[model samples]
Target: MSGVNEDYNAISSVYSQISKLPLMVLERQLVAHALSSCKGQTILDLGGGNGIHARKALELGASSVDVVDISSGMLKDGKTITAASGVNPAMIRWFEGDISSTLAHLPLHKSYDVILVGWTFDHAETEDQLLGMWRNVTTYAATGAKLINTRLAYIPKAEETDGIEKYGFLYPDYKEIPGGISYTYEAFTDPPLRCPATSLTNTLDFDESKSIARQHGFRDYQVVDSEQMDVVKEDPAFWRRFVDQP
Candidate 1:
């Protein structure tokens, strides 16, 4: 299992418990916005935990929502979540594998109108990996389809004066791990013991990310929807208009 597997598998039982949390309200909002154009559209949900976003897309009328995840345990929970919601199994296509492997399963020369990566980039092992993920997404998205994702911000050491700024390929502040930029630090702990740390320099800020998308041949790159989120958002009407492609 990859980092995605370990994290989601650990939370499988408690995943739906988020419905009772305060942030669940906002999460639903974000989810709704992310899937607004689902009706008649094809979608890709990468790192779709518990299939919340995928189910929402189906509800909003997406022709299909393909969920690609690395954890079988997490995929199991996703099935439960969708089933509990009465979603038709035909509406969703679940692939239990890493993103790289899942790419091979997608139809060649076929693409989606909307591709979602909610909080997925932070889980990649390297900058090249992140770039590769982006490349894969673009490969499967129809022209002008939107790519939406989020990442945790970067933080600085406690003794440090200024916190690191978020940039392309930087280590995150919420955890400790090797950064994508040329920064050096002693490893005080080992991987698998803690969440992977992200680099402030190597990570993509909003503008830089859009530019990157454009550089990768994505046109009309823009921020369609964004807000502080603590939980899953379920409203498809919120984001469909801005991010949906013709």
Candidate 2:
């Protein structure tokens, strides 16, 4: 399987486990709060793995959500979970493709009121690629729309051991590439698979990300760190450990 596919496949299988962690739960809460403020009826979940955020949007009264991801396995798992949870499956539209291409061709009655690019834009390998992603998002965003993105601020220089113990995954290899950092992990699969998780936006800091958003015509961009969120601030040690890799 391709790198992204394999990693996400393994991730989907353990989605339930990892998502229970305080860090992950806090992330979701923060995102949900952001969605609630948007008052958006239509939402676009870019790189939405297993409809996690999509379901939240629905719970917050979003009429419909379109989930676009590169991993079909993740989407399948998400569909099953959401259906089981009693969310109308029809309310969530799943698309399996790259975000850049998928958004360009997605057929919708109107532009999306809220666009959630959660923890996905860091995959872009270059400034141009990151800008392209914002442009693609802009193509589908309604006027006076809001775009919220969450990304890792810094890549650790060393391998992490605690992630495997806590989340059942370990990034054992770290390499500094041209644009960002590359991490290699051996995900705990039914039959284990080697997965390389790379972040191409390693060079993009908070200011740069906001600048890119502005260049693409998105205004009032705000960058919020997890530490600043009420849910995460309560447990400084956990978040500090999470951000500080081994």
Candidate 3:
């Protein structure tokens, strides 16, 4: 199996559970608020793990939802949960691949009215990759479509161990990088082994992300805090907004 698949499989079972934590729940709420005013029928959930947001989108009156995730394991788990929740299996279409490549090959007839990139773009390891993601998402968006992307902002002097234990993970100070964040946890193990996960934050701050969106033919952009559901930044989570230009 590929390394990415291995990593995702390791955490697939617990992914949904962890996602329901207060912070994550707030993140989803913020995403829903961003789309509350959107009366569109087609929605794309990029890197949408376990279909949490996808299910919510359907409840919000979306007629069709497509979920693209890099992990088949995650998608499988999502299918089971969404099915049990009484969501119609036919309303969602699942695609397994990297977000950038998947977006490139989306059916010509497919154009999203709303695109939700929730807490996943931060995995892009390079500036070029991030820019490519912006471009591809814009390419698949219909004119006047709303794109909402949530990213983790760097918090100065942030706690090295806040809320980690509640999710059954560890955040060791020794593992900290100067300008990035790290998370380590063991998935589905008796003696739970630690898996090292880290991402660099220097390349995709809010300003840089907004700039890229504008360059890719998006306009009327704004930022909102998921917790407050407003323009103020009272929390570490925020979502960027863009409307594709005609």
Candidate 4:
């Protein structure tokens, strides 16, 4: 499930339990691939919840990491976790701001080496709002910067959601909206959490993002195949359903 502002404030701790899921394990592998060459790079993690991926970037040698999200509660949780761990929390800066809008005027650096937008776009409620999130990404990116992001690629039918719960979250109760669709993304944390989300029809194929990035001067956008990932290749059967629906 994507962390969209206030939706996660009360359940932030419950939300972090997603790390124990198999699909999340593979997803982290993808994130590790994106950050593999991020040593010495400055990074911006939009929609970064509790500094999870932000800390990973720090471990991978990021000189600085700025985490921007809309939830003050989640931001507080990040600082708490960092403080408890007693790591270089000073190296990572946390800011409470919305990525769908309001990131440009914030005191953020304009050019980052790598920008990570982890599942933020799916929360866009309209076309303009969705594009607003893209605007933030491009506005802060450097001229040769790489962007590793997750867009809502597909909205599954309720019937197709049968076996996805084991992955820690299941999006059900699909409802068609003006631009695309809306659904409830339920994370199977001990005491579950739900977030109503939207995904645009045009954006479902990922072309909307590619075009936006290109217009902003990015060179390329490639969709990496999970099947080729070593995590999945090692045991395809174990990750079969997730690879199919993820």
Candidate 5:
């Protein structure tokens, strides 16, 4: 719950409600597009809290998934949900450890076909820690494996709001920290939940991040445009604010 990884032990129960937010539409779209080529493939979901997207991967035709997270509570919650939903719990392996430092020691026996990094990298408090995350990416991912990820890259430090409320979730203004910005990411649900997130500039900077990716054996890094997604094309007016700000 601190430093390179913000353990979500306290808010694990309500965190699943994040999918209820309107912005989740785009997230699902991204996942759908990312997983289009992953049929019968294996996946490694770093920071895959509560198996939300992990289950989505299975639904999208992934053969197996390994969900690594820093929170035991989140893993437990995922297991409970997987068991209750009658989705063979064995399909998803829940491992609790910081993705930044534990990939080598974790029980990841093979390189994956796809690596998921969404809602994962922002917690790094320093550039070295951020590199630690990309390091893990290169570790379990072999050449030709797809790496798909996303985050709130833009920092609305000046404006109070970026018109994101309609898209769901409340991302308040962030304050500058040593090497990043810190803010409470709030999801509006019954008995609301908030996560104190730290997004470093190094993590946000495209040049720097992609530089590290290339240096560490990653290639063909490209940012997918959100405007062209079917979800956005279906309703431009509704998704304007999110796509514009996102």
Candidate 6:
């Protein structure tokens, strides 16, 4: 596999593991809360890694969810998790490959009532890349449809030492797991910060990200909710770490 595909494949398993984490539980709740009024609406789970978000949407009674992912490995893992969770297979439609390419190759007949850019936008290499994806989204989304997404703040240039300082935040240090193979993050504030390029893949200021969205015609985004969950808030470094990574 190439770098992009390999990165996704390596994390595909981790993506599945994330669903079991307390942070993921909060993320699910946040999305579900935003989607409470979408019971009968069709949803598009863009970059639906491992289908965890898609499964939750199904549980919330979405009429249907179309899951699009760039990596086939991730989609394959999603199928596994969905099956293990006993989600109704019929509720999900999986599209494998890049979003625009997939759309061009196999077009969806109808617009989505709700489109989820679930941890998706932060990966764009440039503003144009991100905007292009946004244009595609607006093209296929129904009028008044909601697009839920998340991303990290941009990293500052100089005026700082090496490491996470450039990113304006730190990475929460993780304790070695009992087995000593992988690590589990510890609860702490003011831990070590992370690298932005390594974190979000794409770089953009929070204001810049919002500006791009508005430019693409998405309006009425009031950030209805913005509370850090216990696990994330208690450890101030959590969002600066795991979340901003992917």
Tens digit of per-residue lDDT, candidate 5, span 164-197: 6677677565688888888877778667777778
lDDT of predicted model 6: 0.60
Per-candidate TM-scores read: 0.70, 0.82, 0.76, 0.91, 0.91, 0.71
Mind giving the per-residue lDDT tens digits that candidate 4 earns over 1-246? 245566768777676777777667778878887788999999999988888888888888889999998888788888888777656989989998878876657789878999998877777888788778878888888878989887667667888877666667778889998988889888776887777778777567667667866776776777778898898999988779767765
Clashes of 1: 31
Question: Residue 77 in model 4: shift from native, Å?
Answer: 1.2
Error of 2 at 108 (Å): 3.2
Q: How many angstroms is residue 65 displaced in model 3 relative to the true structure, after the best TM-score fit?
A: 0.5
Query: Candidate 2: which pairs clash?
Result: none
Report the lDDT tens digits of candidate 6 across residue range 1-246: 124455676556555554544545556767777777888889888777678778888888888888888778899998877778878988898887565333666556478888888756644544455556676688778988888875444332334224443223322332222211111122122332121122222323455556666776776664534354454566656456445542
Better of 2 and 5 by TM-score: 5
Residue 121 Cα positional deviation in candidate 6, in Å, after optimal superposition:
1.1
CA RMSD of each candidate after superposition: 8.5, 3.5, 6.6, 2.4, 2.1, 8.7
- lDDT pick, better of 3 and 6: 3
List candidate 6 stretches off by more than 4 Å. 100-102, 154-204, 228-246
In angstroms, how far off is 95's CA in candidate 3? Answer: 0.8
Model 4, position 217: C-alpha lDDT score:
74
As for TM-score, the candidate ahead, 2 or 4, is 4
Cα lDDT for residue 220, candidate 4: 75
Residue 168 displacement (Å), model 5: 1.8
> lDDT by residue for model 1 over 22-114, one digit each (tens)?
334454666677667669988888777678878888888988888887777778887877877888987888877566444775453378888
